[model samples]
Target chain A: MVLDLLASGLIYSSIIVLGSIGLSLVYSIANFANFAHGDTMTVGAYAALVTFGAVGGLGGTVLGLPYGFFVALGVGIGMAALVAVVTEKFIYEGMDVGSIGLLITSIGIAFIYRAIIQMGFGADFTRYDIPAMRPIDALVTYGIRVTLQDVAIVASATVLVVGLHLLLQYTDLGRKMRAMADNPDLARVSGIRTDRVKLWTWIIGAGLAGAGGVFLGLFSRLTPRMGFDLLLIIFAAVILGGIGSVYGAMLGGVLIGMTTQLTPILSELGAVLPLVPDTWGIPIGIEYANAIAFVIMVAVLLVRPSGIAGEVV
Target chain B: MSLRAIVDDPNAYWSGLTRAEQGVSGFIAGFVVLLLGGLFTGILAPTYFLFLVGIAGMYSLLSLGLNVQWGYTGLINFSVAAFFGIGAYGTALASASSSPVAGNLAPAVGLFVALVLAAILALLIGIPTLRLRADYLAIASIGLAEVVRIVILNEDQLTNGSAGVRGIPTFFDGWPLLDTFPQTMPSVAVSWLPSGTVVLGQSFWSALLNVVVVVSFIAVSYFVLKRAHRSPWGRVLRTIRSDEDLARALGKNTYRYKMQAFVLGSLIMALAGVFYAHLNLFVSPGDLSPITTFYVWVAVMLGGSGSNRGALFGGFVIVAIREGTRFLNAFEFIPFDVAPLRLLLIGVIIVLLMRFRPEGVLPPQRELIWPSVVDDAPEQPDSGVRDSKAGESND
Candidate 1:
């Protein structure tokens, strides 16, 4: 049972990690919490759904997912990036009310994105056109039930994260982005065009979020509110790992995802493990999982305003 | 100008007003006339109109509550809906006949319990988020609000789950005279109406009573805010909003002040919720959605943050947007649902408002210093910078 939870946790964590990195990057570089980030994920999911519908599964399949699905994923990422950049250019570029203003504006943007998507898609849950796959027979014996689709999701997320890491560390644009995120003024003084880098940040950040959205759809189902629903959990992950630190976001996402998936077994853990009191356990049900994450977030804010990886203030 | 001057020489006051003020006054006057005409012509029912007024008043109460926190102290609270829901559920669970937990309580008792719960919830949320950066509060409050919604949604034993609590009596259920006033009122028919006789019945009287209840709530809140906004306490909050470091340097406990404003504002929001429960006569988890929070936010911003008058105007604007979209449903040419259209309008309005007029339509124009203190110190030079920062975003 625990192994099954672990398997599910891994799949959930990959999606969360993909989301957190983008949110953290935007928070650091854009100098405001983008409330629209979640809705951008929705845009990606819906965009991919449309793409997958348009392009039927090309003959061969990889890890239970059709090749066309990967093509759809790429389009989703691109579309999300394009939409975000366009929004930034048209709406956000002219605003001068500081970061706080931007934050409020992002809420408006979030609603707009969701409303448009809802208008088109209708307020209903939907799934990709892919056929459902059962848990692998081999893994079911070990109590580790997961499908090839889950493996594919995790693998794709790893690849994306690695690619981002390489882009941040090895590339010149990455260095510029890092420098800009650290200090916009210093980056500008050092001859980097802050505007261009900001545009790039939106693209990369929104692109990753888009990928996360697609994976999230595959893992569960898609609704207009799906991304908005997942937003707070992603926030917990980012805050836990320390806001603005990409690596920290990854760490936080994994921990939060594991803890969330493991919540159903919390009462059993006390009885299963050797403890002073056999019955001593948190009696909370799985419904309180999100609430638990939020409580942990508030607790983190109380004890350490600066997250685990952030510089102590 | 003094109230006495306006009362003594109303014509002079009217003539002395700027073109913009005159235009706004004229618009309001015209709109009221149109509304009354609609009521008399049978185009709009009096009961529905009264209900709209009650809802407008509720939004005004919410905006006023928010004005205390975001307007005066610059606290970014995104959990307005949570506090509002707490008030609604708190009262509903206590007073609703169908309540599985607690039933058959007087609404006054429910109001008291709701306020206390709201205050406690405010402190719990405020204690942690208040000490952080401004935006952090926005994030944390919203996240915590989701927790509140989830709890309300999942805790079926307590909140009656998603089905919601029904059979809530009106606020005057136990009150003497007022309790039976709506029931005792005779139906009235206006014979002079062009569209024939318009009847006002028990429901109309009930709605009128609700409007009266909400008006009292608004009036009491307005009076208290007017006094508080001009007091030394309000000055300190304004200072904190503009420059917290400066307020701290002057030996003010910024956190305490923020928490006080947060709790007070949350209490007002809860008050709105309490009113909503009795008015709507049902409470559901859906009432706790974040959209309600944002709607109040749009009201505050559009009406002019920190200005009570602005809050009132913003409240009316909200009703217009909300009801106007519903009216859009009457037109069959529109293919999409009005719900998404309303969302789109709200989003567009927020974005545009921030982009073009971040100070809002009716930003607080007066200096925030206590009238008594400033009146006695007339020799002090008015700093333009400080005045400009009155209701605009300081950050």
Candidate 2:
């Protein structure tokens, strides 16, 4: 049972981390919490759902193509890019005038976007209606079953993370991002067009955010407030990992995901030896699971306000 | 008329006024503006206008309370919803102690008590958290608000969990006290009107009673804020907002000031919640949500910063726009489904105002200056000659 929950946590972590990475990136370089990020993830998941419905019939033994996954990615990435571009052009352009103003603007955009989505999607749940998720052997070996979707999610996330590492470390554009983040004014004065760098920042940030959104849909049923569910925790992760550090965001996401489920896991911690309520519960308590990320965020801030990864921004 | 008098000397306008003077000024100004706004609404229907006026007054109270903290002290209080919920739950618990049956419920002395208690809750949360800078505070407060909701949701014994505590009572013509208040204020016969008695409130005047109670509370808040802001204490608070380190170095005890700001701001928020609960006569956990904070934020932000008048003005604008949406919806020019857009508009205003006119629609004059070069400059210094040539990537 413990292993099952742990495996589930890992899968949860992957989906959340993807979404969180964008939030972390946006906060670090853009210099404000992009409150709309949760909606962006929701939109991405919606895009994936649309794609599945539109293209799942393309192939198999009798039905053969199997191209829906790629379709989902395209839709997700495209939706994210749209939000990124529109947000930059319409919302964020004038925001640098004030951080608090920008934050509020993001909130507005989030509400607007979420409302639009609700109008279209009808504030109900959406899913693939696919077969049961098959747990992988690795997850099973850990005494917890990993579903097929989980394996697929982990594999893609790993590749994406690796790809992100290469993009940040090896690419010239990546280096420029690093430069811009380090000091936007300096980078602009030194010859790198900071505007162009920031533009790429949006593209990359939104793209990753979209990618994470797809993972979220795969792990659980999509609902109107799915993004909201993860929003605070993602914010906590971004802050925990150190704002702007993709790696920190990922670390924070995973840590947070684990802790959220950990309380319930602890509730069953070996009968008489259970630490909480005869059930191995969270280090804090139950019901607080929803609030776990926030507590961590506050604690981390008191100790290291700059965040765990030491802020690359 | 008086606003015109103050407008001429806008810079020295608010702070220089004495507390009694400020209180009277604020009250008269508030009554006039609200009366005017409501009169317009009332032209269509008096009942509707009174409702609009009362709601606007309550919302203004909430926003003004927010203004004191965020506007005056530069504290980002995302947990206004939490305090609001706390007060509401306090009211609910107090009134419903007897049972779920509505009329049988006990009187709500606790509602009045909860306003102050809620402030203590705010202080408890704010003391440890407000020490951080803006971004951290934003994150922290969001978390605190969530904690509040979750606590309300889980504390089934107290809050009744998500099912929510319901059937709370209002401060009323209905309360038994109505019978007693008339006895105290009394009807008096004047020499000029020997045939009739000039009375404060008729025996059955619950509306009059509610108005009196609300007005008194508003006056107290106005007085306390006016006194504090004009005092040596107020100067210290404003100074801390501009530069905390400087305030600390000057021995102002910045922590206490922030605590005071948080506590006071939260107390006002709670008071507003209490009034709001009574005005609505129902208390449920849903009454408080994060959106509540942002709404108050809209009020405070749209209202000018560090200026109570601005805060009040901002509150008026937010409530007007929100309530006005319904009027516009009646015109059918815009779909009423666009009710959600009201929030979107607030967000737009928040973003745009922060970017272009952060002082709000009625911000202080000095805030209209060019965006500070020093304010958002790169963290590290750019060696002079280097800035002229071109931009370099920092990493």
Off by over 4 Å in 2: A50-56, A61-66, A128-146, A270-286, A311-313, B1-49, B98-108, B172-212, B324-336, B365-395
Give the TM-score (vs. native) of candidate 2: 0.81
What RMSD, rounded to one decimal, does every model reach? Answer: 5.3, 10.5
Q: Please tell me how candidate 1 rates in CAPRI terms.
A: medium
Evaluating just chain A, the predictions reach TM-scores of: 0.98, 0.89
Error of 2 at B366 (Å): 9.3
Among these predictions, the greatest DockQ belongs to: 1
Per-residue lDDT of candidate 2, residues B1-395 (tens digit)? 25775789875767765554466467658867865654444343333444455566666677767877887788877888888778766666666543232333344566665776696788778877988878688879989888888877777666677777656655653466664564566554333342333333433244455556566667788778866776777778778778888998997878888888888878877877777766666666677778788777877776667766666666666666787666666666543355555665776676676667666655543332323553466876776545444566555
Each model's DockQ?
Answer: 0.73, 0.33
Error of 2 at A27 (Å): 1.8
Q: Candidate 2's error at A173, in angstroms?
A: 1.5
Model 1 chain B worst lDDT window (10 residues): B380-389
Residue A76 local lDDT, model 2: 88
**Docking band of candidate 2:** acceptable
